[model samples]
Each structure stands twice: as structure tokens, then as C-alpha cells.
Target: MSTIVSARGLTKKYGDFTAVDGIDFEIQEGECFGFLGPNGAGKTTTVRMIHCVSPVTAGTLTVDGSAAGVDNRALKKKTGVIPQEITLDIDLTVYENLLVFARFFDIPKREAKARIAELLKFVELETRRDSKIDQLSTGMKRRLLVARALLNKPRIIIADEPTTGLDPQARHLIWQRLRQLKAQGVTLILTTQYMEEAQQLCDRLVVMHQGKILKAGDPRGLIESEIGKDVVEIRMPPDRDEELLARLGPLACGHERVGDTLYFYCRDGIGLWKALVDLDLPNTVHRPATLEDVFLKLTGRSLIE
Candidate 1:
């Protein structure tokens, strides 16, 4: 696959505060590339520049051989954005909402009508076409937002927290649609807080914190490289941590104490489990290491405000 989006030392700032520091990454054509970070990690700002909605303060960002900038109409024309916030006009019916957006793209009435019908069916909102935006449920509204973003046939789609505040069924529906788009060869740029969402869609991703790219790789690879095959959690008092570590630390590849839990990251949990059983610790959990473990370990377990 060819590189569709490339950023080198890309930076974004507001006044004296730097939201996105000098960071670099490349998104290949027809693959789901994700930006994963906690709040205020510049994931949103980075993508805003990619879709040409926000101006780049420094360095270079190019999409499909064209420089990405606020005034780049050609780049914007081929990019579709599903914003984090629901910007639907409640006064208009579902069909009218898409119709107005089609007009923004200068789509002809005949073509717009046909496209709207197809998008509505694509998002499974065909039955709610005539309903007012306010009359639809939250899931229906989110689905409509997805349909609206497709008003213009776009080669690249940027979804910012597309499943925010959605139920399991709704979130799965959106995930399925996104996967379908990827299968159809659309380049997808996603920024989401949901670790499961990133694991489900992204072929590769970067973890950002304090305006820096800390790590980048495929989900499973990152987990295996940074963390091992399994994680053993022992919940106990802080005072007992030293004794536990001295006993089991060598049995595991690594260990860390965060809050009440002592995390033992290891390739095989059998020895660790036997060690724990020898000690007879009551509060212990052995489970497979996941993307979430890598995320928390890289970003820190504390709250990010």
C-alpha cells in the first residue's frame, strides 16, 4: 500500500501552549490507522490537521501528494469527517439533513437523492428517513451522522470518537460499517478512547502522551513486545508488596506496583501461579495481556486531567 498521509515534525499550538508537539507518522492507503491517547494528548488536533480542518503550525503534512492546510480545498474535497460532537440540525428531517450537506458539496439534486438513499441504507437508517432529528434515538442519531459524513463520496474518512456515548449494539454497528468501508478500500483515520475499538479496527496505531509519540505498532505486536503473554495481578496492601516482589519478581519478566495491585508481566503464568499458590495469596488474578495493559503501562495508571 502507498502512503496516503504523511506527517514529519508536525506541530500545532494555540497561543503559548503546544497541543501537538513535533510528531511524525504515516498512514497507508486503504488501511485503518488509529491515534490512541488519553485526554489532551493531541490525538484530535493531529487528525484535525490531517483532514485539513485545522492549520499546521510547523513542519510538513501531506495527503495524497497534496500539502494539508486549512485552505487546501482539493484535499478537503476528498476527505469526509465524522466529528466527535453531533452537529446535526434538529430542525430538519433526516433526509433534509443529508440533502443540505450534499448541497454543500455542490452535488446535483438527482445525484444527491440517489446518494442519500444509498447512505441511509448503508447506515441502517432508511426507516428513519422522514423522522425529525430530535425524534430519533441516540443510536439512530449517531447512525445518521455516519450517513451524513458520506454525503460526498470520499476516498479518506476521518472518524473522531465515532462511538462515543453509544450502547454495545450501536457501537458494534458502527464498527461493522467502518470495517466494511476498509474492505471497500477506503483509507480510515480514527481517534478513539476505546481500546477495544482501536484493537478491532486499526491495523497499526501510535500512542501519544504530552504531545509526543511514545510508541507505535500493531496492537498484538505492541502487547507482546512491551508486555508479555500473560499478566498476573496481586491485590494486597502496600506494606506487603516488598515481600511479594522479593518472592515472585524473578519468576516474572517484570513487575510494577500501581495503587493496590502488583502487576507481574510474564511470558508464562504457570510458574508465577505456582509461586503465588505457594505464598497462598488470596487476591490474585491471572489473565492474558492485552492492548489496555500496554496503554496503561505506557501512559501511566494515574488519571490524566
Candidate 2:
């Protein structure tokens, strides 16, 4: 696929403070590209620059062959944004909210009406079209936001934490719609804290921390590369670290102690599992390595705040 978004040494700053510290990455066309990080890790800052909302303080960012900047109307016209916040007009009905947004893109009223009808059905909100925003549930509001973003028929869609504050059913509905868009060849740029969301939607992604890209790869590939195949967590007292390490450490590729648990990372857990069983240790959990494990291992398990 062709590159839709490209950044090199991209940086963002607010006076004396830098939010995005010279990161570089590329997003391919028709693929769901994700930015994953903790709060204040510059994920939002980076996407804001990509969508041309925030100005770049340094380096270069180009989207669809044009330089990304605040004044780039052509770029803006081709991009749609699903903001992290619920920015819907509460006083307006669901259909009205999309109607006003279509006007901003200069979409003709007749065409806008046709598109709105299709979008409401696309997002499964057809029955609630005349309902006020306050009458819709959180999930319905989010679905409407998705439909609103589509009014312009954007080539690229930027979704910042799109499923935030949603239950599983609601979140899955958004995911299905996003996947459908990807299938139809819309380039998706996503920034989310949910690891499962990233794993589900992203064709490729980068993990950012402290204003920098720490790792970038396919989800499963990154997990295997950074965290091996299996993880065994033993929730024993911290003092048992030496005893556990002396017996099981050699069978595992890596080991770490956090809080009251001893984590063993290995390519194959059969040996580690047997060793643990022999030792008959209590509170032991052996499971497959996941994207979350890689994330925590790279970013540290401690709270970012």
C-alpha cells in the first residue's frame, strides 16, 4: 500500500514545554495505524499534528503528498476527525448534528440529506435520527460521531480514543464500523490507551512514551519480539524472589519482580510450568504473552502519574 501519512523528526511544543519530541513514523493507506501510549505520552499531540489541528514546532509531517499544517485547507478537507471528547450539539437532534457538520464541508443540502440517511443506517442510528443528543446513550453518541465524521467522505479518518467510556457491546459496534471502513479503503489513524483496541484494529502501530516512539511493529509481532511466547506470574511474597530465581530462572529467558509477584518470560512455558508444579508454588498463573505484557515491559508497570 502507498504511504498516506509520513513524519520525520516531527515535534510539537507549547512555549517552553515540548509535547511531541521529534518522533518519526509512517502510516500506510487503507490500513488502521495506531498510536498507543499512557496519558501525557504525546499520543494525542502526535495525532493532532497529523490531523492538522496542532502546528508542528519542528521537523516535517506530510499527509497525502502535502505538508501537514494548520493552514492546509486541502489536507483538512480530505481528513475527518472523531475527537476524544463528546463534542456533539446537545440541543440538536442526531440528524441535525450531522446536518450542521456537513455544511462545514460545503456539502450540498440535497447530497447531505442523502448521505445522512445512509450514515445513520450505517451506524445503526436510523431509528434515533430525530432524537435529541441528551436522549441518546453514550454509545449512540459515539456512533453518531462516527457518522458525522463520514459526512465529508474523508480519505483519512483520525479517531482519538474513539471508544472511551463505552461498554463492550458499544465498543465492538464502533470497532466493526471502523473495520468496515478499512475494508472500503479508508486510512484510519487511531490513538488509544486500550491495548485490545489497538490489537483489534491496527495493521501497524507505535508505542510512544515521554514524547518519543519506543517501539513500532505489527501487534502480534511486537509481542513475540519483546515478550517471548508465554508469561508465568507467581504471586508470592517478595522475599521468595531468590528461591524462585535460583530454581526457575535458568528455565526462563527473563525474570522480573514487581510488587508481590515474580514474572517469568519465556519462549516455551512447558519447562517453566513443570518446574513451578514441582515446586508446588501457590498463586501461580501461566498464560500466553500479550500486547499488554510488551507494553508494560517497555513502559514499566508503575503508574505514569
lDDT of each: 0.93, 0.94
User: lDDT by residue for model 2 over 136-251, one digit each (tens)?
Assistant: 99999999999999999999999999999999999999999999999999999999999999999999999999999999999999998999999999998888788889999999
Could you tell me how far off, in angstroms, the CA of residue 285 lies in candidate 1 after the best superposition? 0.9
TM-score of 2: 0.98
Over the stretch 1-305, how does candidate 1's per-residue lDDT look in tens digits?
Answer: 99999999999999999999999999999999999999999999999999888999999999999999899989888889999999999889999999999998899999999999999999998888899988998899989988888788899999999999999999999999999999999999999889999999999999999899999999999999999999999898789877888889999999998888889999988999998888887888999999999999999988999
Best by TM-score: 2
lDDT of 1: 0.93
| lDDT value for model 2 | 0.94
